[model samples]
Target chain A: MSTQLTTLLAVFLFPGGLFALVLGLSLKGLDRRVAARLQGRIGPPLAQPFFDLVKLGFKRTMVPATASQPVFLGAPLVGVVSMLVAVALVPVSGLYSPDPMLGNLIVLLYLLMVPAIVLMIAGSASTSPYGALGFSREMTLMLAYEAPIVLAVLAVALRTGMGQGGVITFSLTDIIAYQRSHGMFLLDPVMWPALAAFALFFPANLGIIPFDIPEAETEVLEGPLLEYSGPALGLFKVMSALKAVVVLSLGIALFMPLPFDGIWGLVGWLVQLAVLMEIGVTVVRLSMGRMRIDQAFGFFLKWPLLLAIASVVTVTIVA
Target chain B: MTDHTVACSYKIPVGPLHVALEEPMYFRVAVKGETIETVELNAGHVHRGVEYLATKRTLLQNMILTERICSLCSNSHPEALAMAAETIGAVEVPERAQYLRVIAGEVKRVASHLFNVGILAHLVGYEALFMHAMQVREVAQDLKEAVYGNRMDLGAHCLGGTRCDMDDEAITYMRSALDKLEPDVRELEKTYRTNGSILRRTRGIGILSHADAIACGVVGPVARASGIQYDVRTAAPYHVYDRLPVNVPVLDGCDVWSRAMIRLSEAVNSIEILRVCLDQLPEGPINDGGDPYIPPGQAIARTEAPRGELVYYLKTNDNPEPERLKWRVPSYPNWDALTFMLKEAKVADIAIIVNSIDPCISCTER
Candidate 1:
């Protein structure tokens, strides 16, 4: 409505949106590097993911004759939009709109599911056997990992506790501010284990190695992406990379405990966040082999799940 | 006579251009509601008429030809053919060459398992673990480079035995590499076995009954996973596998999970084999022969490739070039099991299960 509002929206929506897109895609590149290093080879550069996205974006799109057109076109866009929403929530700089709470932890959590749900619908819409197959995997993965992720987030929420300023807010900014003031990661005794829990669960969230069954290229070509191509495919590729960044940012926001409010601190924190995410992913990827689908479920169901529950209960008891 | 009846059958053409398995293959699945009635495999996707080309190249030139057969099992193809050449001419290989051949074969085995298991993990949605496994596997790739002098086409194998020998420094470097991979491999094995979601999807998904496995002529881990217990390494040990004892892990489940577990266990066994070979460090020349080209005759050589029993049949007339060369890759037999495996496998398991066999399409088609 106002020129000032328009300028502010441009900063967050344009640069912030582009930053999320670029950084998110950068995660994919980071993932490639980390994966390569872990596998004992020199992996691709940080720019490798961008190249892949451009390559996939420019490639011709093929759709099965029997598939529904809307679902095919809509799936990848949903992936991009949801990630964009997630990025908008991340406190990149001190600048904030009237309702910064829109990017809060709870909203981010709810939004995270949109891309995956969209993918499931797309997979179901496509008549291809691989699409249907990938759809089943995506559903199964959501069911298995969603609880652990929620539990991990809850653990972070517990560690930060509630501020004395007002009614307890689940806003990410509030959580970061609380940590920044009280030596962040230093609050909850269970923070280290919670961070570890995030480490184990994050790969599944990003669909990087060890948790990339839904789009197993060797087996299913590209999973939910079986039939997508051109711009639509690029969006999915970009969204995945973006999702990687969002997950890493969430990890940093809750765990890194750095003061990202200052300009220089924000840049330093972002770089550190990027490097940490890349190193975490790379070390894990190259060091291990894949788990079977059932085995992956088993892993989530076991120690990670238990730790999540334990962290929540511990926080509750301590409070 | 049994009537050839298309009774209540539907044709589901898979591949030559589709997902679930790489290297173009088409399976016309005739099914009666998930019960597969018959399977017709069309395998001409990657058939480059390599057998025809064998006549045009000299024995030495064919070495590179054999390597290109399968990008994954590049070393195994040429190694088997070279072994056949040695047998045809009754050539005596140097002791050092024998050790080197065993080293190369075992190292490739480790690397191939890493590659396959990584794919299996990737297919199942464990991207991080897949990358980790492959990253650790790079140690084997590095070792391949250090010992054989190349990563993919090691150029190590020859008619007599091998073209490469390890010096003390190189042997020490290789020993350290094995040492580095041991812990990582152990950690991966622990994670895969305990990881619940992985077990859920893979366990009992593709139950290849022992009877089905035998009838299908399944080789390598596919058969072994089904309780067939037929590892060419133990049954007919070649290239020093006879001297060393290897406990073949056989699980009766015969599903995708079992095959995957079998690969993991074999990877462990391969590391042990490499360690032992490196420690032994026998002394001799790299080769003990005249020209490696064999005299006129037909010879069949067999070796335990990463996938399974890879056999190479070579027919050499007096010409410097062989008349014909046929590489019987393990995937050929294993791919046939797909029709049976895919029957009622909830479509999602199709790709992951197919990848568990580590099908080398290039080698099979070549």
Candidate 2:
């Protein structure tokens, strides 16, 4: 009963529901502030995303008359829920490790895909033309990016599994513990290709510039999210913010899970998260323009896919 | 390829009120997946019947009314109207007023071109570059506010000559502003020329061929971009443009990038022209002491607006108001060419292609 209760608290309170929401929203707020400063404008306050959530909570959620009310309204809820669980699954080295019964990398990977699927379903269920375009673009982009990410994860799993004198390990705890003992994969030459591939995946998955074609604001009027307003729209924003934390923290855990233990590990992890957010997310998006849907699809197939395959082949040979 | 994936076609509305467009113009776009198969344009959302209203106002009053037709191309209307009035009246504008007239037109061209390019950056989702471009345009905006006391409508033209006189202080301010503006514009031009993000989105994206351009009668930078070496300031040589070193930059790329390059080159050229106008500004009255009487006759006049050739046809009779005032704005014919540009374009390129024409809907519909 206590184990179940602790797991519930972990999911809803500390690292997943409330904790991830605040941290994720804070990261998004920091992103906006940093982007504004880079663009030479006085951006909104650090608490802007929180204010937006509160403001959205007050506004009436308007559903398009033609929309599938159940699917359209329900999609964001699923995304938010998936992200909450995903966040709890991300282990902080020398700090909090998720209960093994909670799940592993495969579960997190499946959870990682939920937001894009939600967006696609939300788009098609809206019954608008732009939404349909959004649906197609989202599906295409996800298909293109998903393969490389899976291979990259496979490479990491094999790398950790092989190092442990086994075939493969899907457990992220084993991966983090292995890194803690064997030193960081971030410095390992064999792992560079996977790291590069994963870095490239950041913007595409986060839906920012360069790969933000599915929700290209100028093109399809933000595509799927066009019809959503009020708390419903706020839920989508919450999903995005939480997703950023899961993805970024996953990056840290996979490659360079910090050596420091206790509260210092928590502090170092967050500082690392902010640094990674600023460099990977902030600087990259500021300096790039969005790619066309076909161009983005082609780009993923050309660069990241090749890199992922290289990483996998290299790990296999080295092992 | 999978049998489960169905090849389907659908219609999407690009605007009546769309985010990409600054004006209310609708494009009924037919799409097979992501590619736009055909585009149907619906205009006149901004049809204010300004041509009819031009006849209701006196020539002097029409100067203000005509300038209000479109904000971006505001100065061109009154400048063209004043040219028509001068043609009918056979008034020789003073050299100083002529130089002043050119200065006003070129300033509007610089700000307008920067705005269009800024929007292009915006449409590509380069928000930083967009904000930077708009920030750069603020120089011209400040210059306008300083000199003409308004940002959009300069009210620069009068029947015989110019209404706005640049004193030594304004001239010095303009010269200093130009000195500051020239390098910033050059830097902007270079970024657009070399930036990978910009090139990937724009290059070979919107192909409006040279032959197609002529067939559509597209004018100004749109024509110049598609390799048609035409400019009203050069071809017709109105005002003091004949005297100024008007470098009409032409490109054969025939794409959105080329259109933007043409505008950038023109923007750089306009700054040089402004400098010359201020230097060679002859000593004379800005305009005739009062509004000169335009004789009862019909006259046609054209000037290069920021968009393209802006033509004004005016006819007067015994009444203080003109009998008729008609115009052919550059955006009018340019709208037809969108069918060709948007032919088989991706749904994403629709906004960028539409914006490349720099379509002034109010000017076109008015």
Candidate 3:
């Protein structure tokens, strides 16, 4: 009973619901501020995203007459809920490990795909032309990026499992433990391909500039999210913010879970998140242009796919 | 057609309120599964009847009214209109005024070209490149504001001369600003030329072949990108362009990248022209300030606006107010060519192709 209570506390409080939400929003805020500064303009306040959320809450949620009322209202909720659980699944090095009963890396992988699926469903349900266009692009992009991500995860799982005298392990705890004792996969030359593949995966998964073809605001009018308004839109924002935490934390666990313990580990993890967000999300998005759905599809199939496959092969032979 | 056949194709209406466009122009796109088959455009959402309004105002008032037609090419309208009025009235603009007009026009071209390219980066999803381009463009913006007291519409051109004159300090400021902008623009040119991602998104995406461009009567960067060597500055030398050595950058790639490259190269040329104008600026009165009356006559004046050739026609009957005022903006010629560019484009390329022409719906509609 106490374990159940602790699990509930973990899901709703630290490292999950509230904490991840705040951290994610703050990171997004920082990204905007830094992007503005780089552009030589005064950006919004650090709390601007949060204020936007509060302001969104006060506005009315207008449903398009043609939209499927249930899916239109329910998509963001499902997305937000999925991300909340996914955040809890991400083990924070020495500071916190997800309850094994909650899930593992495999479950987290499926959970991570929920938001994109939700976006697709929301778009289709909206019945708007742009939303329909977004749905098609989102599906194509998902098909493109998913292969590399699965391969990248498999590469890491194989590396950890092989070192521990097994064929494979999907447990996040085992992956972190292997990295902690044997030094980070980030520093290992053989794991560099997997690391690179993983690095490519997050920006696409997070829908940053280059791979943001599905939600290309200028093209399809933000595609699926065009029809959403008020709290429904805010919920999508929450889902994305929480998603950034889950995906970033998952990357750290897979490649470079820090060796520190307790409070220090948590602080170190936060610092790492900030650095990764800055370099991967902020800087990459700032510099690059968005590729068309076909171009992005071809890109993923070419480079990251090859890299992920190479990483898997290298891990198998090396281990 | 059978019901099954009808089911295969669907029409998607983009914009009357779409995010991709800055102004309201609806495009009814027929698609057969993500590939655009046909595009039908419906414009005039931003029409303010500026041509009709111009006839209501006096020659002086029409100069200001024409400037309001399109903010991006705001100065071009007034400058062209002023030239038309001057030609009809047989007014000889002072040598210094001619140089100053070139300076204003070139500076505006630089800012306008930079803005179009920056927006291209934005449409392509290169936020950093877009921001950097805009930041570089701010240098030109500052120069305009400092010289003409307005960032967008300089309001400097008049029938006989210019309303604003550049002092030595302003000239020095313009030189320094150009100095600061040159390296950054050069770096941007390199990035656009070499960046694989940008190349993939832009190259071969929206091809407006040289033949198609010529047949459609496309102008400015769109024509230049398609290997058309026609530039109003060189072809029909207006004002001090005869004194200046105008090198028009023509590319045969005829794609979005070529369009972008043309704008960048043209920006560099505009900077050089500005330097020459500053050096050759003669000492004289800025304007005649003679009789405000324009005798009964009709005259046409054309200048190379940032987008393309801007033509203004003026007719007067020995009165303060003109009988008729008309303009032929570059975007008008280029709008019809979108059908050719978007013929076989993917749905994703729709916005990029539309923006590639840098279509000014306001100017076109006006």
Candidate 4:
């Protein structure tokens, strides 16, 4: 209701959402550029993603005969909107988000899950066998990565609370405020392990490799995205890119809180945030190969899950 | 969630057309409880009758045709065809030509391996690795262009010798390029070996034992990954390989990961071989052999391609064109092994594992 909240919401919705969408695509382009250099060939242009989106956007979209229309139609829209909501919740270049409470740790986590759910619903709606196969794989991936992600969130929450003289706070603003008073990077050293856990989670949560089994190109053909075309696929891609921004931003927000507290101080904070996200993604991706769905699941069940559990314990201990 | 739905098993199909690998293939998988019961591969979608088309094209023309088989394994086809032609012609190519051939071939091997590494990254959704791999490969491309004047089809080989000559400037360029690549390839190899995600995904999945590889008739990296020490370069001694000291990496795992590792190791080895060839290269004419002949009898020649052993069978009838040419590319044997590789691997590995063979579907179908 306040003008500040309204302004913050506007910034998050347009710039934050757009920044993520564009940044994610740019990440893909940068990936191509890096790959080209490695192969000893000059690869496609850095704006290749922009061109691809334009091409896919103009392509035809035909629903399969066996598809369920509502789920099919609603899935991509929901994917985009949910990502938009996540963007809305995360403070990008500002002090707080619009309806800042929605930026509560739990709500942000739930919003992150919505895109995957919508993807499954849409994938199932297509009724294509590949779609079904991809959807199932996506579900497995969802289960695999979710625990680590939740634990990552819990680690940040507990670290913030423990560092703030034993006050437990779930609010992003509160976490930021705590960090503003007491430097964020100086939270519980146990939070270092938790941060490490989150670092791993960022890739899986965004479905990047070594954890991208569900959408393995050879096996699933974009997984839940096999049947999507034209604007629908475009929207899905945009949402994915935005989701990258959101997840990375969320990671940045949790551990590397802003040095500046005021809204005007956000420019420097956002730049630092972008660089951190880029470096994190670049390092992890370059260093790892992809995991098979089963292997990925096995991994989640073993180490990442343990890490997550450890974080929760760390939260309890630190809190 | 229904018992009835769970009780009855159904068939699901995925792609003869999709964006996993650049090539398209179909699969009909039967799943009974989220576990795949059976997987049936449907190839031939991308088959453009390359073999049948080979029957129509002349031997010299087919060199270009063969290079088009796959973007990654671009140099293997021309090398095989040229070797086959040499066997039929009974011509001993100049030593310098032999050295040049080996250098060019090894350069391509490094480039091809890097490309496969990128695809492996792409498959696992490791965009960063994919990009880095490709970036490193570009140095090889530059060398290719500098040496042969074309990145993809170097147009180097005729029957007895190559079309392009490597001058001092080109040699200098190659030296500098390898210097840049040495560190990059090492770092990339380390990442593959140590990264938990990649190591987890590739280490044990799609394991093909030594027996399975021999039974399936796998060749090249696929066979080597299963601990087979059969490299055509060392075993058969093609070109200058008999003269040069080459170490073929043999991993005993026989799994998808091993195959990937073998390629990485080979890339480094190829770089070493190139440096040796460069140091020892004798100064002579690139192509001093007389004009190529269309022999009356058939001749079989084999070379160690980047993938593995590539066998070329040529039947010339004393005409400008060859009567018949049959190429036993590494992929023909490797593709047969795919049935075994994919049998146990979770479906997600199909792309990378298929890519690990560097499956030149164009070469296979051709």
Best by lDDT: 2
lDDT of 4 by residue, B72-138 (tens): 6667778788878777777778889889888878888898888887787777666656777888888
TM-score of 2: 0.98
RMSD per prediction, one decimal? Answer: 7.0, 2.2, 1.9, 4.8
lDDT of 3 by residue, A1-319 (tens): 6879878878899789999999999999998898888777899999999999999999999999988899899999999999999999999999888899998888999999999999999998998888888998999999998999999999999999999999999999999999999999999999999999999988889999888888888888889998899999999999999999999999999999999999999899999999999999888988778887877889899999999999999999897
Native-to-model Cα distance after best TM-score fit, residue B35 in candidate 4, in Å: 4.6
> Distance from true position, residue A220, model 2, in Å?
0.5
lDDT of 4: 0.75
Which clashing pairs does model 2 show?
A: none
What local distance difference test score does each model get? 0.74, 0.93, 0.90, 0.75
Over 4 Å off, model 1? A1-114, A117-129, A132-219, A236-319, B1-22, B26-41, B55-68, B71-111, B118-148, B154-205, B231-301, B311-327
Model 2 agreement with the true structure over B1-366: per-residue lDDT tens digits? 658866588899988999999998999998999998878989878888998888899999999998989999999999999999899999989888999989999999999999999999999989889999999999999999999999988988888888889999999999999999999999999999999989998999889999999999999899999999989998999878888999999999999999999999999999999998988999989887887988899999999999999888999998999999999999988889999999999999999999999999988888
The superposed Cα distance between candidate 2 and the true structure at residue A7, in angstroms, equals: 1.1
lDDT for position A265 in model 3: 98
lDDT of 2 by residue, A35-74 (tens): 9999999899999999999999999999999999999999
Output the number of the TM-score-best candidate.
Answer: 2
Between prediction 2 and prediction 3, the one with superior DockQ is 2
**Predictions in order: chain A TM-score:** 0.88, 0.99, 0.99, 0.88
